[model samples]
Target: MNPKNPYKIALVLLSLFLFGCKDSASIPSEEDLNAREQTPQEESNQRTTGPIDYGYGPGLLPLGDEKISNEPKIGFIYSCDTQLNGGGAFKAGEWINESEGYWDPNKKIMVDGDISWANAQFTLETKGTTREIKGNGLPINHNTGTYPISTQDEAYLYDRNPNSIKEQKVVLSLPVQPTLAATPRCASGMVAIALNGIAIFNGLDAGGKDAVAHEIQDQCDGHPQKDGQYHYHNLSNCLEDTPRDTEHSALVGYALDGFGLYGKKGENGKILTNADLDECHGHTHEIKWEGSLKNMYHYHATEEYPYTIGCFKGNINSENLSQPENNEKPSMGPPPTQP
Candidate 1:
């Protein structure tokens, strides 16, 4: 009756087969893409060998991504936001939940620019032309206990820090390899930056008091100032670092002169003291830096005063280092010209 309709039947079967195979060749699924095409160092644990979050927020940056090219070789990856939780609210909006703000020594709370301005944020960048190590000076972390001077009285050596934590774009053209300065000298403030993006001031409080001794610090060993900029005046455990066992010292941060700063311990399970270091609280050795393979000159934090760095071991970046003491309040410039 239907004669030889076998040819039509065969064509329909072929079409079905092609349709079934079409989905197989379709664009790869997300799972497949993730398996096949993630960054080389994308799968590392931050605590072990990558960028770490100092309780700021969540993001990923591979510290050992060899494909990343640069001039100022970064020892570690940094968050674009400097790991700051931002000026306002704990998570979102403009400080709706003020309860989450850090507690002052008096158990009071401080908010961004509320009593004063907010903290600044830093994002590291490479100046393509000059090979300068560029960073946005951010006031991300600070202890509210002894800060804001709160009183607009010149008697306390301040009315208020005229400067808020505005992003101060700081740059330093460092030597690829650091060398000894002819005569090392101590500066007014900010000899370095901790890995968490906080500035490291010298071990001095207002009125030239020993910061680590007399100044009120938070549980993390830091405090803020009139500018609302949070910083460390001594060796603070707030820096994110792998806990050294009984015998291994860990690198904490870098000095402005291009050397590394280490913790208060040595490799031999010995508590390093100021005696172990030079005038700058540093010594030359075969340090196991994240990127360096050879021995180099680096500073170490002692249990005593000037816990981090004492002075400049290498040529200091004059543009980056300032006479913070001279201004003691760099923010205190002339008042606005009122109409």
Candidate 2:
């Protein structure tokens, strides 16, 4: 059951009536069915929005039955202060020319036709010298002998030096103080606008699903779980936007059916790293993936490079939550062309 349609009020009413008339063995009359059917508006109120868990939103929202906050932390760290064209544009990271083996920001578009680009623009407004950090930490996977690498160019010991891979720590740390610029600096590959870290996208058809996997896995090398949804980090290279400047980044929204950032194991447990991006709550929306590494609030996107996905430092103030600076124009970069 899609948790959104949780328990029905009608069922509750039926139980109450049955208990009240314990001796009555006869089936409910038409009146009971009519009364039950009249609660559609009540059900609508309860079922309109999917389950939201507080864990996913850092205690800001409810995490439902799934622990969506326990996945590996992967993102980028950016400083607001580096803009091009007089804070009018953000620096853009060069797209990779290839599509095999390693992950890169060059291929963040869906190949299929269902999920197209939505002209939603995002900007970074600062109150003071604010610093934004985004990163994902993956647990040590001993079975695959896989580890994390901060950059795409970093050579994994397994591919180059097998013996060295074993000696090295199972976890690889990639740290950077991203410069905030109007250029597309931080974002690369597909980026989902997750609140605190919970994905909030809609549904997708089969082709759209393939397109999402191809874009995410192909560009970021995220491993596909048994359900075929890809989950992995891509290259997030970004520059910072300074006090008087801003930055931008591109994003792709994938339309998936019952898709989320993670799924569930049993009824009450979270499916950490499952084949389903189920933690995103199957709300039949679009998952917006970033094309750059810059941090911005989960809701904004930009065609400019070096994006500030959410709030930026150096500009923080009392209006931190209410007001943000997004001075860039809404323009879309071309979808993945080739390589």
TM-score winner among the candidates?
1
lDDT by residue (tens digit), candidate 1, 5-76: 000112211221111111221221223312221111111111121122323222211111111111111121
Model number with the top lDDT: 1
lDDT tens string, model 2, 222-334? Answer: 22222222232211111011111111111221111101121112112222121221222111222222212222222222111111121221121222122112122211232
Question: In model 2, what is the error at residue 262, expressed in angstroms?
Answer: 19
Each model's lDDT? 0.42, 0.20
